[model samples]
Each structure stands twice: as structure tokens, then as C-alpha cells.
Target: MSIPENARKYWRANLKYLAVLLLIWFAVSFGCGILFKDFLNRYSLGGFKLGFWFAQQGSIYVFVMLIFVYVWLMNRLDKKYGCNEPNSRKK
Candidate 1:
């Protein structure tokens, strides 16, 4: 069965958001932690070398933030596409 055009467009937008966020996460985690560690090591954050922090704790923090971002983005997307759940409490 063919999917509705609106559904297709919604999924496309959702995937786009996923792709961009994932790419950012990858760049910050893998790229900064490993590939660019030397350059990042020159800087410090919270007294820890930047690259080392990324490899150890920074990535985890970024991932958590990204989770929140994804939730926010999805909530907005759902509202835009009329897929959000109805409010549980009404005045």
C-alpha cells in the first residue's frame, strides 16, 4: 500500500532532523575525541583538557543534551503534523 503524501513528507522531515543531530553528535564525539584530539588538547574546559574531556565526559554530556533536543524537536514536529497527543488537562 502506498503511504499518504503527508505521511511521506512528515517522515522525510523527521529523518532530516535525525540525520543532522546524529551528525553533530558524531562530529563532537568521535571527531573531537579522536581525530582532532591534538588540536583540542591545546584548550581546557573545567580544568580538563578539552579532547580528553570529550573522550571521557564531554561526549556523554553532549549526548544527554541531544536527547533533550530530540525530544523538543519531535514534540514540535508532532504538533506541526497534527500527530501530537491531546492535552491531558484542560481549563
Candidate 2:
């Protein structure tokens, strides 16, 4: 069977969001934590080295936040595409 054009659009949008989020994740988790650690260490966050905090805690927090963001975005997208659950809660 052939996929509908709307389905293809939905998937394209989904992939765009996923790629952006993953890029953010990678930047925070690896860029600040390793590649730019020296530059980031020049600052402080709650008295902890910025780079260290990002490596140990900040990235984790960002990831959790991103999960929520994805949920919210996808929910909106589902609604826009008429694919949302009828009984689901709205944002």
C-alpha cells in the first residue's frame, strides 16, 4: 500500500523535530562537557564549574525538559493532523 501524502508530511515534521532535539542534546551533552569544557569552565553555575555541571547534571535536566517539549510538540502536531486521541488532554 502507498503512504498518504498527509502521513508523509506528518513524518517529515516529526523527523525535523527529532533531529533538532537530538542536536540540542548532543551539543549540551558533548560540546559543553568535552569539546568546549575549557571555555565553559571559565564560568560558574551555583558555584560549580559550568562545564562540570553540564556534563554531570545540566544535560540530564535538559534531556528531561526536551522529553516534555517533544510530548507537547507531538501532541500539537497530532491535533493539527487530526491524529490525536479523542480523549486526550489538551495543552
Candidate 3:
């Protein structure tokens, strides 16, 4: 059983990116939202406690930003690996 070198590299890169992004997601969603809330609560954001904001709002914002970042990163990765989709245009 043998895998092509390019395929192996692509999968490795994909998984690496996946893991990093997921870790960040977990940290924001769980760590800030739950574990460090007390510490964060000591601070305030826009008249709201930071910890409460993170738990109720900031985590969601972070998640949405992460999604955009993931898309941008993956597009770059696709180009790097020469697996990008063909340009589709009528010219």
C-alpha cells in the first residue's frame, strides 16, 4: 500500500491546519468562556463584564472570524498544494 507523495503532503497539511484552527476555537469557546471567566470578569468591555461578554457574545464573534480565517487559509493551502480549483470565468 503506497500513497503518492503529493497526496500525503496535502493530507498532512490539511490536518495540521485543522488542528491548529480547532485548538484556537476550543480555547476561545471553552477556555475564555468558562475556565477563565472569573479572571476576565475583573475587566469590562463597553460597560459589560468581559467574562460575561465572552461567554455570551465574544465567543460567537471569534467563531465567525475563525470561519473566515479558515476559508482564507484553505484557499492558500490549496494553491500551495497545487490542488486549487480551476478559475471559472467567461471572457
- Candidate 1 collision pairs: none
* Best candidate according to TM-score: 2
Tens-digit lDDT track for model 1 on 39-78?
9999999999999999999888999999999999999988
Against the true structure, what is each candidate's TM-score? 0.89, 0.91, 0.87
| Candidate 1 accuracy as TM-score | 0.89
Model 3 is weakest, by summed lDDT over 10 consecutive residues, at 82-91
Question: Candidates 1 and 3: which is better by TM-score?
Answer: 1
lDDT of each: 0.91, 0.94, 0.87
Candidate 3 stretches greater than 4 Å from native: 86-91
- The best candidate in terms of lDDT: 2
Candidate 1 lDDT trough over 10 residues, lowest sum = 82-91
Candidate 1 vs candidate 2: the lDDT winner is 2
How large an RMSD does model 1 have? 4.2
Q: Where in model 1 is the C-alpha error above 4 Å?
A: 86-91
